[model samples]
Target: MAPTKPLLLDGSTGEGGGQLVRLAVALSAVTGQPIRIVNIRANRTRSRPVGKRGSVHVTGGGLKNQHVAAIKCLADATRAETTGLSAGSATLTFTPTLPPSRLPRRPLKIVPESDASSAMLIFQAVLPFLLFADVEEGQGVEVEIHGGTNTSWSLNYEYMDLVLLPTLEARFGVRVERELRRRGWSQGPAASGCVWVKVYPVRKGESITPLQLPIPLGKERDTRGPRDHFEVESVDVALVVPLRLLEPLQTALARDIAGVFPSAPEIDFRVVEDSGHQARIYVLLVAKSPTGLRWGRDVLHSPPKGSSANPTSMADALSRLAVKQLVEEVDSRGAVDVYLQDQLVCFQALAAGRSSFARHGDGRGGGVDVDGVAGAPGPTPDIEGDGLRREKTHEPFGHGSMHTKTARWVAAQLLPGVQFFNKGDVVEGAGIRFA
Candidate 1:
């Protein structure tokens, strides 16, 4: 059936990040609506050639060059196809041929083996449509995406499993069943992977209420170095490789984490074999937060330089790097913590009423409160609270005034609010709401 509300998505939203594709696809699946996208990744990269001759423009140039060709939807699908993409400059256009009401029985198909990055981009563009198919129509959405699963520019399968899936499930209540039919890595033998998404719409009773600022209370602990004390709900590491390479990878990861946080308990690691040629690694970290559950993923591959030495070393380094980045962002006193802040937009939008996140003047304030308990505060506290002797101590929660300039702008556009603050407690508007 034709969708009632047509969501016109700007290809360049959220710091002009490709997330516009990701969110748009996911939302389409949930809402079962057809969306039109123009100027897709319009600002991504400039047209340039690797050398003086045989030079090809980047993403934009490629699109312009393909404009004159016989552009057609690939097999009644939402994606467009054109050969000689790098032949010349052209203007490309996209229009959804099939409405939600007229969607075919067959699952959506996207075929593009040469530019895995473009394939991934297309997936994000169409993912939302699939996700909402079942929920809106009470039927499952089957998707067969053909492209590089482990390409440098695309999201590795490991990250999809370890990080992205878990976050969606925990925060937004999304359930997806997937199978790795084949493995495809960058500049290697290509293969395919299948993902089945089952979305259960929130029951009337299960709807989440909007939260307000100073969302209260929780004790916090440092989980960084060895012997550091912090409670972890779960930690799972999965590497895409053969059994022979699994053990060494696991050992290296554990040792690395131990070196960073000795006091933390042993983390669990799992290995899944991939049929493709290239190797990849994905890590998922989950912990209880004051507000709810916090989840993070690190998807990376080994640098090509050391391919000859230790196969798993690259995986280990990537895992460690992902963890370090997450911890650092969470520990910062900035207005919005990076990943969580970004992922929270969907939840905030889906919320029944209203919700607010604490804004740290600098990314250095104490941890936020869940209900009434407080986590560690940032380096310097701006507001003063009561001291043990009844004197006023510094308080981080309400130190600064509510500056909703950016948030209001987003809210005005019917989008989520995103705020930013720097080290000197100077609040500034950020283009990407979540960083």
Candidate 2:
């Protein structure tokens, strides 16, 4: 039975970003609970001019174009009623009309209001409901999303297709087939694109198998130390840049990979498409363990603002930056990178039994640092203009990123039976089933 009173969530909690809204609404739809979020995106504050004398004043909060789209799309999928459904709203309520078991397994489509809105973010927001939806044997749901595939602050389409989906299937028995119909880029003039996702949802009576920690075998290389590092047997690189820079990027990538990994794992150029504009340059490197564990690190290059900027130098720098970040991830000896570390939390809460992953290094709190930035892989939301700036927390607890910590917090709030221990290294799932 649905709760008579809506579960209240403070938007300023934890990471206090779009993720809270995404996870809350998805959980509400799947668990048949109603949620009311106040102070939405409160920590995300924007600065504007107070007068004409160049003095700036801070104004904060509210949903972006992509966030509002995610809530509405998920509501449509589950027949949920919503309040404050417009963009820039600071408070919202979501109440599903139908229970999880009654959600029909049918094709759904999502089109974001702006070309710059991330399709992958929309995918993350609605995926849980689809996964827990009612469906017959041999039945699946198809979701088509339209928006930017490579956005500034969100996960790109290539990462989801090559890394995220595969790891989910390999580790937790959740299968989602992703196909890219067209390429989208937010850097160069905000291009629109499309993606088709077919989900093999967990049926009414069946539940997702619990996640088990990966056993640490000996390292793939001849390292004279502990026998705890999981072997990275191969690496796949996806590079999207101008056609003129292809050979240079490939050369730099090979040199960097050899210098860092030293294990001589098989390197495959999975994607080598031309991004059509120099500003749209992006690269993703995914390391695969023989145990089916995958970790990914990527960057969408934002070239210096100058007509005199050299394309060759920028491309080389982009390659070097991506390589350096990915090497950091591989050296940490964690099962997943900082981003995926948190992304998996929701699934852990939804599954039955216990789920855990090997903590990175001594399991102390740490995060990925690209160039000199602390928290995010891309441009940390611009706080000066209409953008918001947030800080990263490194308090000692399982070494998970702020996003990871926030995700675990949200799951625990929505699913009472789910409990997290050792920071977020271990979790007891809610064992959610449609039937």
Candidate 3:
């Protein structure tokens, strides 16, 4: 007889922003647990037509169609509709088609209509599941995500490369091969982009040894200009639009990048003319990392009125803003440092051994904090056999093993035999772990 699969419940699957969906899908893939969600994107506005005539042309339509296993409600209707998901903006219900026993059963297939945000979210949801899928010694999984490569409300290719990909590879030991087939943008449906991701899983999980984060190298000065060591090499800008709007976007971005990085020789930008009505801009910022971080950002707004000097003025503005943010974070000493703190959590759990991170106890005086206490014996009986045991402690604890402490009271949870600590001291999860 087949074993009964445990159901993983996501309280806010659709709540908050897209994070809920992304996290749920990622964790589901990691834990090999099937999930059923009731309120998908409950906080988001229902799908709406991008242009006039109530014609649905947005990527949300693609999402609604692709995941037919999940049912959604119209804002006003009592019954859910598989067809015409645009009846009215309403809540979505997602139920996985297969059980955990059947996951990674086949490479997941998703075809999004040039909607980068939706496509990325779908990718986040399914990628983790694929990573954990059962593969032979040398088998790799492939997923084809179709959408606008450069779309508003989505992390352009640059961020996926620099920020997202680097962090994932470093922390989770996940290696992926990606190829961008075509470019899609929000100028209209005319700009279509395709990308394929090949995922290779780390079978034994990350090394159990503790990690030691290196201090960031200081800023460097070059003959061309004085820039942060983490400075963006060049932004590969692409605008997918009608022939008329093409020149306008190019001129605008060139001007903007010149202003931002005046000393740099010139901004390396490009344009792809595919569809006339739709226009999207894709910017890939080449970083100076050994593995060359690729950060992508795009502008998917409507064409500007009165070509007066700057036709793609809005696109220029948004792109410049994104570049500024990316530069600031990459250059700042604190950005990657903060991320390292958060990312270590998953690795700690996977290590099946205690791991530590260098962090200040009270926001002062840096020290190493032991994150996972799995090796320590006998706080209680082994409950799940996932190396997780609960223990009753005289301190405050947070959900899952994260904790904080105060002098007044000791708050924590004892899950049979699990042990938690903070600053080399035992603490509880009363507030730190839960909200």
Top TM-score: which candidate number?
Answer: 2
lDDT of 1 by residue, 66-111 (tens): 1111122221443322222332323222334343334455655555
The local distance difference test score of each candidate is 0.41, 0.74, 0.41
Superior candidate under TM-score, 2 versus 3: 2
| Candidate 2 residue spans exceeding 4 A from truth | 1-3, 47-57, 211-228, 307-312, 360-398
Clashes of 3: 39
Q: Number of the top candidate by lDDT?
A: 2
Please write out the lDDT profile of model 3 over residues 158-242, one tens digit for every residue.
4454556665565335567777776666554545566788876545332323222232344233454434323445665554555
Q: In model 2, what lDDT does residue 121 have?
A: 92
- Name the weakest run of 10 consecutive residues (lDDT summed) in model 1: 388-397
What is the C-alpha local distance difference test score of candidate 3?
A: 0.41
How much does candidate 1 score in TM-score? 0.59
Each prediction's TM-score against the native?
Answer: 0.59, 0.85, 0.55
Q: How close is candidate 2 to the true structure, as a TM-score?
A: 0.85
Q: What TM-score should be assigned to candidate 3?
A: 0.55
lDDT, candidate 2, 1-435, per-residue tens: 555579899888878888888998888888878899988888787555666767564544588888888888877766787898888788999988786666655688888788888989999988887887667766778999998899878989989988888778866888898899987888877689899998888867777765443434653463764332345678899988877778888888887787777667789999998888867788999987655566799988767556565656666687789988887777776667778877887888888865655344553322322211111122223232122222222221344677777787788778887755544565667888866
